[model samples]
Target: MKQLFDSVRVGRHALRNRLVMAPMTRSRAQFDGTPGDLAATYYAQRASVGLIVTEGTQPCADGQGYLTTPGIYTDAHVAGWKRVVDAVHAKGGRLFIQLMHAGRMSHPDNTPHHRAGVAPSAIAPGSGMFTAKGMQDIPVPRALSTEEVRATVADFAHAARRAIEAGADGVEIHGANAYLVQQFLAPSANVRTDEYGGSIENRARFAIEVATAIAKEIGADRTAIRLSPGMALWGIDEGEQGPALYRYLVTALDKLGLAYLHIAHQGDEALLADIRARWTGTLMVNRAGRAREQVGADVASGVADLESYGAMVLANPDFVERIKTDAPMNEPRREGFFGGTAQFYTDYPTLG
Candidate 1:
């Protein structure tokens, strides 16, 4: 069995282990989309992990979906993230900022400029989002014109550059969940008849362009992307063609020579196998709710180069150490999962 403690390399960084810290939204940033003050401490405390993929950070103003979620577009945003990158690097960790654009999964009130959400089509996600006041129904977003779509792609590239400037080892384009990139990938969320919609190639164009642009801005070695093959969250349906779409998309992305393809597997072993076969680059798998005993099963099975964990890493700062020693882990406080202080963020006890 390939142990989780084994060291690995992804892109340009040499990781200490095969355990990755998956990106997760904590909603603890400043109201202006700057990462919270404790962000440095929070990430640094978990630096023992092989790789840290930070929360979904917006690439542009219209990308803001949740309250206090960070962004990398502004000067302040870059400066704020520098502290986080410095802190993580100081502890001998590699960090990747996950660049996210929320698309139709957003509310005007949640954004810094209160701008309307944008998507490939003007559709509502049929979901409610948490705002400053309370949970509010998501509104129909304006469909991005071909020009706007190009601009959005540029925005991702710019954000990736900013993340690099902030001292991050790399950036992970958030092509998963029900975000903008996935909005384009899912037929239900995309009803456009333009070049960016309709056929599978057209639907996959936006994500490819975003990734290409980021790779060009930085190096292909420092560019990575996260994808969820058939996530139905927020009313997104990739259709029965979902599996095929991913096969085509992954093949195209694989040729780009990206750092790694992080797949948030949603229980489709066949599809996962297909993606693994199609992709030649490094592969990282995030299987939510996997038991403690099965932590490194994917790596051991040769299906994944790295295995990512969220709640376990969130609740246990010394998660890698705990796994090595078979030590008891602190339970994650569900109530303090979002918009909280150090109580649950940086205060997670490490095995001492």
Candidate 2:
């Protein structure tokens, strides 16, 4: 039986355990999309986990959606991430920077360029986001031209190269949570008539192309993606075709021999079973609101090769140690979850 604490080969790196610190956006980067000064300390503090997936990092200027989210495409961004990578590595932790394009889930006031966000279609997410000015409605994004779509794929590949240059163990494509990649998979968000949209295969083309490009640029063993099938957030509705689309999408993505596939599941046991059966590589599952007793259940039951925790690890810097001792966990403070100083970022006490 595979225990949660067992060592495993995830990609080019061998992890110390199976506990993963799932990527959580702390919105603490500088105005230039560079990671904040405390980022190194914050991540290094939680380096006890087997893997630490960084927050949703934009790949390019246009990819920026939220205020102060880090990017991976520039020299300063690379330098910022290098410090973070080194901090995590020095503590014996592996890290994968998550490349996220927020798509229509953005506002002009939040980005540096102050331009409308880009997406597969000219549609709004029917929601608002926090900005410098305050809460504002997300505007209808400028639809990407078919040619622009291909260029965007190149942008992901370039970012992957930059991440590797920064000494990261790998990069995870943020294809979940109604981001650009998931926006393309969602028919309601994507209404393109070009080769990039309409049917399931066409809608999945951008993700496959982006993954293929990144896998080619970096090694496939260093590339991974996260998906949230049937996730109905911010006006994203995959509809009844959700399961079918994922079946086809996973089958195609599995052929790439990527490092692993992370799924932010949403109560679809049948589909989850199907995904587990079809996926041949490592699988990581993040169950929202999972109790302490269920920490190692996924791995023990063979549902997932690795189990990820977000809030638990976020609030408890020594999450792995606490789990081992069955010690009480610190409650996550909601107020300091985003764009804050080190009060809640790094002040979490650990077992002595």
Candidate 3:
């Protein structure tokens, strides 16, 4: 059985252990999308993990959904991230910048130029997003032309190049949650008859193209993606065909020979098993709200090559150490989680 502490190879890097710091949204970046000044210190503090997947960063300006999320498409964004990459590497850690496009999950008030959100279709998520004006209902987004769809894929590719320029080990395409990529996958969110919509193949095309473009710009070994099958969020309903869509998507993604497939499992054992069987690359699994006792269960069972942690790792800087010693952990401060100062960001205690 593989242990959680076992060393493994992911992409071109040989990781020290199988514990990955999952990508999370901290909402602490500058309003213009540069990473917060404390970003370096905060990430370097948790460098003990096998890999540190940075927060969901936008590939372009239009990709920003929530307030103060980072973007990688600009020189300012790249410069800001260089400090973060240097800090993590100084601590002997590997980092991947997760490129996320919010699509219709956005509000005009939260983005630059106050432009409308763009997606595969003009449909609204039927949800509200927190802006400077407080929570506002998300408006229907502008539908991208087929040409614009291709341009969006280029945006992801451009961001991947910029991530490497900022000294990141690689980039992970955020194809999960109810974000742009997931919006395309969700029938409720995507209703176009273009090549990017209609059938399972069409809907999966956008994600596959984005991944392929990134892999081409950067090496396939340095490219990765995260997916959450059957995630019902922000009025997203994959319908009964959701399971089939994932099976087709995973099988197709496997051929690219990218670094790894990270799955944010949504409680379908049968689908999870099917995904595991179909994907032959390094697989990282994140079980949200996973308990302490079940920490290494997936690794021990050979179900996942790596296990990712979010809140526990966020609250405990010495998460790997505490796991090794079976020590008590600190509770995550909910108040300081987003758009905050150092209180809950970099002040988490470590075992002496």
In model 3, the clashing pairs are none
The count of residue-pair clashes in candidate 3 stands at 0
Residue range with the least summed lDDT across 10 consecutive positions in model 1: 1-10
Question: Which lDDT values do the candidates have, in the order given?
Answer: 0.94, 0.95, 0.95
Question: How much does candidate 2 score in TM-score?
Answer: 0.99
Q: What is the clash count for each candidate, in the order shown?
A: 0, 0, 0
How close is every model to the real structure, measured as TM-score? 0.99, 0.99, 0.99
lDDT of 1 by residue, 170-240 (tens): 99999999999999999999989999999999999999999999999999999999999989999899999
lDDT tens digits by residue: candidate 2, 1-352: 9997899899788999999999999999999999999999999999989999999999988898888999999999999999999999999999999999998888898888999999999999999999988899999999999999999999999999999999999999999999999999999999999998899999999999999999999999999999998899998988788899999999999999999999999999999999999999999999999999899999999999999999999999999999999999999999999988998899999998
Which sections of candidate 2 miss by over 4 Å?
Answer: none
lDDT tens per residue, model 3, 1-352: 8998989999999999999999989999998899999999999999999999999999998899999999999999999999999999999999999999999889999998799999989899888989898999999999999999999999999999999999999999999999999999999999999889999999999999999999999999999999999999998999999999999999999999999999999999899999999999999999998999999999999889999999999999999999999999999999988887999999988997
Error of 1 at 31 (Å): 1.2
Lowest summed lDDT window (length 10), candidate 3: 333-342
